[model samples]
Target: MTRQVRRLAERTPPQRERYADLLRAVAITAVVIGHWLAIYVTRDGRGFQGGSILQVASWTRPLTWLFQVMPLFFLVGGFANAASLTSHLRRGGNAMGWVLGRTARLLRPTTMLLGGLAAAALTARGLGAEPALIGVAVWLASIPLWFLVAYVAVMVLTPPMYALHRRAGLAVPIILTVLVGGGDLARLVLNVPYAGQANFLLAWLAVHQLGFAWQDGRLPSRRSVALPMAAAGFAALVLLTVVGPYPVSMVGFGGERVRNTSPPTLALLALAVTQTGIALWMRGPGNRWLRRLGPWTVVVAINSMIMTLFLWHMTAVVIGVMLLYGTAVMPDAMPGSALWLLLRVPWLACLALVLALLVTLFGGFERRAGRWAASVGTVKGVWPTALTIAGVGAVLAGLLALALAGPGHHGPTGLPVRVLVAYFGGVAALGFVRRRYSRPARIAGR
Candidate 1:
């Protein structure tokens, strides 16, 4: 880790905005730790039962507002991608090539995760494990994959979105926020069943656009600007939850009739605004703190294993549950009990250790892929960039199918065969594709 951090720190350009990297690392790590904290697993002979603290304690719902970090991720993603795209254009890179490179980085660690789960399911089944148990394990382990689907879709759409950013500026997120409100109305007030789902794209896109505003200086970094923005967001969130139809939790915990996360309602947009405000407000102190080599080194090191951490985190939890909880090494106390709360410290420690080992083993793929230059690889015989899109499409389709199908020993290779094909085909496309500079790239000069 020290060697890796030294290398990364050496390559860090002095002008690079380190805060964005800090946010990215913080966001992804928080989510991983949050998952480990929320999920509770126990064994009943041959069966495994899992539930979250939210199922037991209702008062914790309000805490979701503080712990939910997905919005912050989209915000920072916008900041990073905007900078990256601008840099790519300055280097005479094509959009297709950019899409291919970004998708590959996102998908590389994902492939390992999916592949590992599939193999684990098969091995468990062949060992005479109950199908229901296998299914539960697989489903629980794969929960984090949902983020990749949304994130990849966003990455694929960046070029067009960036173009819109260039033209519309802050109006984009505002319009998106209004649309998200409309979506919530349709889903809750009018009973339009699937209307809320649209915000999955609309809300996040809006948040991403805010990142663009931050990047281009339209979103000012000042106490005067950020504090009011945060106050307004906090007010709106309270109104939406307390006075309006939205639930209190930013996440979809049990007992909530509506989930702010599943489709990410207008309330989440409000939460995003608040988080953005706070993040911007902290920029000055954060920037100064990060100027020191030691602090910046920690940020870079964490950022380096980020994808690995996000992808394998839940897997690590599952393994820890089976090895520790299943073997009775970690005692199970009632959910939300004093003992249960106390036990979680060790539980988290074990999960983190397992996760570290996973990263050490599988992180090589992520590191190698991360070091890849930001351009499409060129091939001699065919149009690889075209295939890049098709591949990404297949990968997305496959991931969606797998999530819909749910993981288990019920299908070929422990998952639906179609999903396997989609995933493998997509990975192949991105891996084999080639890059060719085009006039369009020059036209998009920074």
Candidate 2:
């Protein structure tokens, strides 16, 4: 190993390995492509169609295996949380405060983006655009914001959840398995949304709990993680297609009666386990390559701006589409045929180029606030408090904006109100609770 790789390995926390960042980069890239294909591949000049793309790529259903990589993001999150919490406890720092500070840093840019989008929508409306078009734009724009809400919830709940990992031992996976099986049955018998919105805590949280296992060193040994993960993932896919009502698409299409993502089914959890295992297996080679890339500079640079990239990639696509409109180069209609899918290659390239430019220009959202700027760091126990306050304020402001401006108005509420509310509220609640319990640790001497 090179000096850099040796250093990284030495510094590697027990819970979070260097390979997890590589996994995150890969997962995010997959998400971008998956979203792009799901949107641009099956459109009819107005919106998406369920049948067209599915028929073209019957394999699209299995893309959920790749596309469901979002859970891996959370899995890494759990590992990071475990490591951070352990470090904080050892040093007599406030665990809650540490989580809050990090959570705040994560949430600040998201709130700003939502606020800006709301302003833009209002400006467009002021210019006398049609209500339907405005509504659609706002709704579409708000889609990426869901990750912010979900991530916050995971961070906030992680402390206690990590504790549970120690107590429950392997029973944790047993309970999750039961929930997965039971959830499917309930959805079938009840014919209700019970499995959809209701399992937000159960399903996705279950995946996050697996991350805790990784932290506690209770997960399978690094050398043996892959086989079980692949086996579990394959089994979940078979079960979902065979017995469950969930559609296999990771990205939502307009006409699918059941979305694998809306509540995240057993299939997604299994997929995470498989992906995590593969990621762990790849870590050794990956770390060597990452080190060879020189000084951790490139990886560190990308890590700094990941949030910005995630938030704006779709915006880049939107800009590309708009710029191409009203030209012969532009498609007269959205592509549905295999020929059109072939033709769309250049369009996809153009979209990627535009996204890169936008990110280059406006990616500062990922930067941490300097102490003088907003006091949002991990120092002095104040940063986390500030973060919690800001996050809560943002959610409240968003809710108030929704109530005052109505559902049709600009801001976070313009999306599915229930989802927005649930996500934001969950984040805020988690931050508050984490902070509350972590106070005593901060008071103790290091």
Candidate 3:
């Protein structure tokens, strides 16, 4: 591990933005830890059930403000995607190839996750495990896919979005913000059905657009931009939540009439703006600190398999629950009890150990898949780009469907056949795209 880290550090380009990698690593880490912390699992005489700490403790809802690091992902994603897409285009690459390259890293590991979950669910059912238990387990384990759905959608739109970014500059995010606000108004005030749903893309896109600005030097790491942006966003957040109708929690809580996160409202967008400011404010110092070999090495290590880490972290929790709680190896306590609070320490440690093992086993897939995708020659032509886009859309839809259905929603297989068909069909489409269009160069003297 030490040798691998050292080699990665040596190979890293000097001009690369170490801070973006650091932020990505930090965002995914926070998400993993936050999730592990939020989970509230209980075993009754009947069976095991899982829930969030936020359900029992209202105080923790505000803390979600700190843990809602997902915006950071889109923010960093925008920055990275802008850089990546631009470089690819500059080298005469087609949009289809660029999109394929971008999604390969995400989909490859996702395939592993879905396959593993399906197999596990089937095996559990064969052992006569209750379908309800399987459903909950599958649901909890597949939580990360929800984010992938949105992130993948945003990524597929990057080509046109980046082109718009080049043309419109800061106005893009501003317009998006206004659209998000309008969506919230229509939903909350007018009680318009499905109006808020649009913000799911608009709000995140607004945040992501900020990334393009940041990448191109339009959004600078200056107090002039950072302070006012932070203040306005913070002020808006307060007004939206306290003075207005929006929920205070940035994440969705059970039984909330209006969640800041679930379709996303102005409050969530405000949070994103504030976080963007904070990220910009810290960019200067953070990048300076990341210049050190030690910190950079740590960031590189975390990011190398970051997706795998995020995708499998919840599975680790499920495994720990079965091993420790299912068999009564670990005693249970009331959700917010003092004992439960104290028990969190050991619970976290156990989950971390299991997560580390899972990562060790699955992280290689991310790296290997990435290399294979990179090796495929870029395909050109309008049809290829259109088909690739369709392929990506199918994958996103399938993932969203599976996530909504839950792993065991259909029964013991842990996969709905139709949903799996859509997802795998998309994967197959991408595979077909690669083979049909990609032309590997002949070896010398062959």
Candidate 4:
């Protein structure tokens, strides 16, 4: 066995919470629908409905409020990072190496996805498809790429982030509140350049930091976590509606007056606080239920592929929509009346079926290979590690910006095809490097 694996074996088992897995499952399911619904263009092309059996389902939007917990996703990510990092530290594992290894795993599948999409786009373009259609396809395909960029930024900055967590203590929240409050002020006064986008790093990192706190047991006990979270969520909603310029929607759409995303506003930060609180509050009950659910080997098994699901769920939705398009059984126009919405139950069911099938087929990307276990490395210095992650992320972000930015971005023609192609290419290149550089010991450690 590799040294890292042996070390892991020698260590005591860390606290295992099935509820976290359950929460992750819930989060992934929500994201599936979020992405699916966001792209779900209605027939008149006026609003979102797929030109498929799912065309009748418009009732899904209300669920957005419930399921659009992207903040929660980060919250959980933070929690997991804390747990993993803590475990690694306890085991005398290299912190920097562990972080890089985890980050690398996250990026690998994403890279493969980008490459596949790029190849498909190139082949279609070679066949003389209109440039506009190609651009739209590529742009649509790249929608989930943002998560990768944001996630890497968070992971790469982990060393300093952890240090900040150690030093700031409760001051972290005060700083976050100030930053979020300032963001609100800026939105009211100065039109910041990609201000919301900028916060994809800062705002979410704060939530992730909360996860670290959870690991350290610094958060309040289970009894108290929920009420505070709910109150925080309520307060955030009030601020967003009354005081802040941000919109209510967690996911961006074309027509909103102002987006809650981009550079995340105070509202989103509030959402994160609230989400963290809720997750913590439910921990007691959630853990008990998850424990009874039995080994949760399946959920834990699925964890390996969580990134895969996130990356491909949208693609599955697109494919399902395409398959159902131009069929009379499927409505060209989405249901307008209440009765039509009621009839959409079956269509939504059908869409779900299609999504499941796709997941089964392509989800293997989530599984770690035997080779991965063999590739391990010693942890390096924090600054060097952070710089490596930052450098890579910066390169990707710059490339994406160049590709995705344009006039009439709302139109199909304006979708970012070239940038997406580059992204996939970059991912593939990274994966190649990983495979080449992977050590047996490191893989085992992971």
- Candidate with top lDDT is 3
Clashing pairs in 2: none
Per-residue alpha-carbon lDDT of candidate 1 for residues 1-446, written as tens digits (9 for 90 to 100): 68868877878888999999999988998898888888877667646677887777777778888789999999999999998888776667766767766776878788888899889888887888777777767777778887878888887899999999899899888888889889888888899867878787888899989998999899998899999999999999999888988888777866668889888888888899899999999999999999888889989888887888988888887788878885555776787788878888889899999998999999888877775644342222246556767888899998888778864555534677888899898787677663333223444443
Q: How large an RMSD does model 2 have?
A: 5.8
TM-score per prediction, in order, is 0.94, 0.78, 0.95, 0.80
Lowest summed-lDDT stretch of 10 residues in model 4? 47-56
For each candidate, the alpha-carbon lDDT, in order, equals: 0.82, 0.61, 0.85, 0.60
Q: Could you tally the backbone clashes for each prediction?
A: 4, 0, 0, 22
Write down the lDDT that model 1 would get.
0.82
- The better candidate by lDDT, 3 or 4, is 3
TM-score of 4: 0.80
Q: Give me the overall lDDT of model 2.
A: 0.61
- Which residue runs of candidate 3 sit more than 4 Å off their true CA positions? 326-329, 406-408, 439-446
lDDT of 2 by residue, 422-442 (tens): 436746664564545344443
Where is model 1 poorest over a 10-residue stretch in terms of lDDT? 373-382
lDDT of 4 by residue, 1-446 (tens): 13433343234244675566677877887877655544434444443233322223334433446666777777677777767665655555565555556766766666556666666666766787656655555555656766666766676566667778888765775676677666656665686754445565667777777767776777764656667767877687767745766665655555555656666767767777777777777787776665533335456545656777777766665566566644554555444455445434544666678756755665565455323522444444445544545536544764457435632242232335555555545555444444444333434356
lDDT of 4 at 222: 65
